[model samples]
Target chain A: MAKRGMLIVLSGPSGVGKGTVRKAIFDQGGNDFQYSISMTTRKPREGEVNGEDYYFVSKEEFEHNIETGQMLEYAKYVDNYYGTPLKYVNETLDRGKDVFLEIEVNGALQVRKRLPEGVFVFLTPPDLMKLKQRIINRGTEDMETINKRMTKAVEEIRMMQDYDFAVVNDKVENAVESIKTIIKSERFRVERVFPEYEEMLGDK
Target chain B: MAKRGMLIVLSGPSGVGKGTVRKAIFDQGGNDFQYSISMTTRKPREGEVNGEDYYFVSKEEFEHNIETGQMLEYAKYVDNYYGTPLKYVNETLDRGKDVFLEIEVNGALQVRKRLPEGVFVFLTPPDLMKLKQRIINRGTEDMETINKRMTKAVEEIRMMQDYDFAVVNDKVENAVESIKTIIKSERFRVERVFPEYEEMLGDK
Candidate 1:
């Protein structure tokens, strides 16, 4: 059997640009990690391929998956379901392919409870002040909503303690570079190399 | 006080190219880690700077340091004493500067005993068969000595379980790159970044 691969979860508070950094990492085309395709009940947008963009499914299918404990993590938005299929992730890892999941902090926490061995990376803003500035610059939320976001951001950033690594998203390029470093180093970690080395040494 | 820097120890079995990999990493000049200068009683050869090349010392002084428990780890080769200065390493780390140490397998084990927090990296040859070939090609040792060395190499390689990471030294440049990745990702590890992030989050 092939060696199981790492489950890399990139997550942080909202407005920390996790999605932008993840896109940059993929667009750079250096890594071979499989993007964890999310199963969603919402209709795919124009030109969106079913498997590439997401695993398009009916509401009944999504709910059945949830009841069967097949969803690694899921969230509902606008009366639609979005989730990661647990079986697909496990199969990919079993095939020695790393699975990359860019998710919200809450969803990441949920995955962590199920897979503590997974590498949870918390993408952080440079600072709280900077994060607040970014949110304010968006100019989309009302004052009350903005204040609530700021508080939520602080709370989520504090949850960085649960993460295996914390990469400050000061710049998209730098963040992508650091995440690459993490993945490379993780492959060399002792736990991953121990069995391989022992086998090479003729250990049963 | 600055955050204590990581103590990165590069070690492996004899003839595994630990020295070559370490030299490539520093010669590449991308890393800023200060090489932990060895305090030696051996006479400085041509062009060997007192501090840059080594901390040249008399036999009496080296012996005094050994008596005082001031040497981090040392090994006697021929008639010369070579070991890392405990004081310098601690002071540098306290000042937020990393210290890199390239030493023998036994010496690295000693350092691990004293400083369990250090990042011990085992630089492995591709396989034991390849390692045997390297030793045979060297052709310096008699058959009996060569057999002893091969046995010793296997024993030392088993010590990799004490290490934090095991990098395969298939190519010098690749090993150097992997070490660089390890250093970079280590700084982002939760144990190292927890304090920094907590302070950023207003922890006292």
Candidate 2:
């Protein structure tokens, strides 16, 4: 029997470069997993391909899929529905291919509740001071908005306690390498690989 | 306060090449952990440096250490005492240095009882058939001894349930790399790293 692939979830607070690190993972190649192409009712932006960026569908189709439980998880933003398709993810994992999901923290929270076995990684900045500095450097915002954003960032970071691993994004390269190490070592976890070895024991 | 270093314990069924894989890890360098130097009452063989090979000690001294709870775990083998000194391990970890222990499964079982936080890694042969073949290739062992050894090997493998990771020694290089990945990834485990990140949260 083929081994079920792991669900790799990458998420963190805003401005922590989760997207950049996720992009770097795929761009560097040698990855054995498939990127999640979310299904969305939102129309494609300039240069965005339908199947590449998302499985663009009409709102009616999206709502029908959600009704039928075809959507793994979904959310509506600006009157547009966006979600991961349950069928694609299940088929890929059933076929022994991993699926990678790089989503916002709120999306990850929903997925976390739904999938108990996911490898949820929380990417963090070196320290809160750096994050505060980054927020302040975006000088276009007024002081009130800046304070609000900092408060929100702190709240998001507190969510790291829910994760299985916390990786500091001190350097993109270092964070990427640490993530790769996590993926590689996770395969050797005894619970994950014990069945194969047990088979070899042969009636013992 | 310094972060406490992890204790990495590597063990496996006989002939699974635990020692070879461990040597490959340390020999390749870039390792931040100290190799376990067991204190033993056995006389050193040729070319064996006292402290480098084993911390050669008198039987009285070894017994006294054990009686005082200085020994993490100990076992008697052929009229000699072999055990890990708990004081050295604690001091090194207090200084934030990791320690690697390569031992037989019985020794691993003892350490597992003494140190719950240690990373217990079980090295496995690719399969039992390969192990039987190697046993047969030895030719000097009688059929009865061969069967007994196989049964013992099976018994040892059952202890893998106590381990956190199981690395297949399919190839020395691959096993070495996997061990390195395990070591690297362990550093990011939330429970090990959460305290520092929590401190950064301050009054939150």
Q: What is the TM-score of chain B alone in each candidate?
A: 0.85, 0.86
Lowest summed lDDT over 10 consecutive residues: which window, candidate 1 chain B? B195-204
Note the residue pairs that clash in candidate 2: none
Model 1: CA > 4 A from native: A129-154, A202-204, B129-154
| lDDT (tens digit, per residue) of candidate 1 on B74-170 | 9998999999999999998899899999998879989999988888899987665365455647676577766675676567667878898988888
lDDT for model 1, on a 0 to 1 scale?
A: 0.84
Best-matching candidate per TM-score: 2
Model 1: clashing residue pairs? Answer: none
Model number with the top DockQ: 2
The CA lDDT of each predicted structure is 0.84, 0.84
